[model samples]
Target: MKTAKLDKLREQIAAIKAEIVSVERAQLTTPEIEARVDGFIQEMKRTVANDVLDSAGTLTYINQLGSGAGNWPVVGSWMHARPAIGFAMAVTLNPEAFRAMVLEAALKELNGGRQEHATGRVELVEQLRGKLRLLEQDEEAEVLRLEENGIDALRRADADPAVVLGLAA
Candidate 1:
């Protein structure tokens, strides 16, 4: 009976060790998470390109437009490196809760911009505003449901030397 109990205890310990390894493997490293965030930015760029193409109708037309004077948000550079990684981690940890929080923050920034009229970039501004309106309409509940966690993530990311130095490769 004594021998059987010891063997069973060892088996349980081995099982617990295996579970620990699994959990560790499941977690993403900071670099990996940052890469994912960069990937998301690339997708945003593609979407922005499509929107611009749609608005201008043709590549020739777009080329003729030249650089617009209005402060249009760059699609890829919308989020700085550190905050993007932090938000990415927050969303990864609790996607359902944090996605809305991230969206709320983005929409707030987009809406906070001063209105511009009769500018070369008016089309771009209007397009972004329309998308923001759609996002606002789709959000189900109040913004920042997990405010504490999001803030903590941002703080941690801000403190990270690599993130601060913009070396997040």
Candidate 2:
């Protein structure tokens, strides 16, 4: 096995570890990143909401009343859903808390991505270490074999040249 390749592998492993460390160090505080995420979300949400509201126009709400009291067939009328009203109220009541919740969710997704990348790097390091071990074992075996061959050659040199060359009677 070529030790040059082994050295290169070691270098690559070190580089990935360093990269992981850099990413960790460069990370912003949770609050700071969350604030940024909240701002981004707010901007994007408003943009999209404006577009959707412009295109979809206003929502119409209707109230219906039907007479059905303890009968085999109960007839009830359903009106338009007012989910937007609820959502608007919720957002208006506690904008900060809503943004914080969104920020936390965004942070969770970001952390998950980072964790997946770190896990991949760790697996790569383990694979590289396993290869290095195997290569070292191979090199050790080669060295031992070479040493045994050298000893046999020395012993043969001390004997008659005729016996060494297969000319012994």
Candidate 3:
């Protein structure tokens, strides 16, 4: 059980790494990174469809891990060595709850601006937001739900996926 928890924690850490890298790429301020943001968004969709993550919800988690200006220590340490492994999901994901996870993720992804994101510390955050923002109106519940649940729900989701699923179902 402890090993499982450790593995899960490592996965969460990887998610955080992805967010940081995305933010880092976003900070580049080059048109290319800006354009690549769409690529990141596509990546997010794939992650979500596979249930690997909930795109924007990952971004929100990235945002929470960041300082108000977008400096994320959790993302900082691993973003450099392994960008792919550090990705995280948005902060919220249930639409009936708060911010519309995708939109919320986009907002958090965009919130840091260039300076905060410029640090080499962040990972793939920049390559995605624009695409993430394109989510259909009806597909926005998860981000909002993240906002509503905050850390409490994330913790519960970790502790009891069955219970959370039961509640949601």
Candidate 4:
């Protein structure tokens, strides 16, 4: 019985290993997808910067207001109030910084799912290892019990009588 359980535990470990491999192979973004997202971000930056430049007077006016300059909460609230203008100004002021922030946010969102699945796989592997260790211990104890009792115990424990008797000799 212990041997049977050990075999099942080993099978579970093998399956978990395979699952880990499979999950590792399944990436959230391919090179093509990354390139496309990068291209889109660059295009958006250019478009937003140009739009902001065209409306420089408007931004200057907003900056004169209490909500537009040097205050982060006010700026954030202004952005929430006027997303297009705020985004345009943000991209226009520093395109590279804007792109970096956008990319960082995008990558975090993209990788979050993969990270969750990998975490689950790691947890499952740990649980399976724990179970495997216990089963191995049980198997070792069972072997010791068999060794101490000899073939008579095997015959008495529902093993084939003929086989146990033959092996006893």
Candidate 5:
């Protein structure tokens, strides 16, 4: 069972690597590329949840959680459920498995740091929103600063002569 799950996870890892390489062959805008990468991350999470989880008895209960059958949206819906229940499952039942899964995921994303486009998963998940909000605020602040300082700074720097010449260089 362990070997089978590991093999399946490795196969998913290979698919993600191929996805990253395929993205490079395209001439997509940055946002478009980011969106595709985001899709890959979601797929990775889904792969871990679906493939690596579930042993016989646990599968029965997950089903008993009111799924009436077995599978996701249904199981997930029933688990709308106590957050602690999910947390306990993650910690007790499948912690090491998912740790390995996510580690492989991140290593694949970095491609040993050769891939410039990869963002850490935490950044992809959480910090990205914060980064984006901060960037928006920076842009608004910069526009105001540019209005206040733009002309005088340009004039002063231009009078220095070296600034303009350095820019041309």
Candidate 6:
């Protein structure tokens, strides 16, 4: 009786192992995961490209600050009193850090001493920072995954992981 029960348990364990393997096989294949990662990377690259364009535009505006073309009557006075306006603007135009600071300051002023408004602004800033950090972390993780999994799996799947990853051979 004891021997029969042990054999039955062993068989059940083997069956469970087989089921686990089947489930894993049913999950996303290496190629699928690589494609997803590549998509994410491309999306992030586009976002960064857009940010660069915005930063370039900001730089152009700063360059024209003292050109005496804008409608600001203070332009002449600003040019005389503060010749370093371009430098100041450059320091403040950082989209990630400086823009966050500006947003926080604007939120504070707009809140007008409301505690709930201040809290909401703080939450918004924290959320934005968290999202940016997650994107960087995800990219790092995907790169590491590709390196660890090796290109052999991709070849077996008949897909070029490098091309999918947008990496030049």
58-120 per-residue lDDT for model 5 (tens digits): 555544453334344444643575444455455445555655565555555544333333444
Tell me how many clashing residue pairs each candidate has: 0, 0, 48, 0, 0, 0
Name the better of 1 and 4 by TM-score: 4
Task: Enumerate residue pairs that collide in model 4.
Answer: none
Residues 1-169 of candidate 2 have per-residue lDDT tens digits of 2345434544554555555465554445566676676676566457445534443332321232223431211111111243353355456556788887887676775664433243355565566445544444443444345466562212212233443344423
Local accuracy of candidate 6 as per-residue lDDT tens digits, 64-134? 45434453434444556766554344443543454445445545453333222322444554554444344
TM-score for candidate 2, residues paired by index: 0.29
TM-score of model 4 (CA atoms): 0.29
Query: For candidate 4, which ten residues in a row score worst on lDDT?
Result: 151-160
Q: Give lDDT per model, in order.
A: 0.39, 0.47, 0.42, 0.52, 0.44, 0.43
Q: Which stretches of candidate 4 lie over 4 Å from their true place?
A: 2-40, 46-82, 101-169
lDDT of 3 by residue, 1-169 (tens): 1234434544554465566554555544444354455556556456545543333355556445555535544344445654554342332232223234444454555565654424433333533432332221112233335456562222323233333233331
Query: Candidate 6, residue 62: CA error in Å?
Result: 4.9
Candidate 1: pairs in clash: none
| Better by TM-score, candidate 5 or 4 | 4
TM-score attained by model 1: 0.28
Q: Flag regions of model 1 displaced more than 4 Å.
A: 8-21, 57-169
TM-score of each: 0.28, 0.29, 0.18, 0.29, 0.22, 0.28
Candidate 2 least-lDDT 10 residues: 70-79
lDDT of 6: 0.43
Off by over 4 Å in 6: 3-10, 21-28, 62-169
**For residue 17, what is the lDDT in candidate 3?**
51
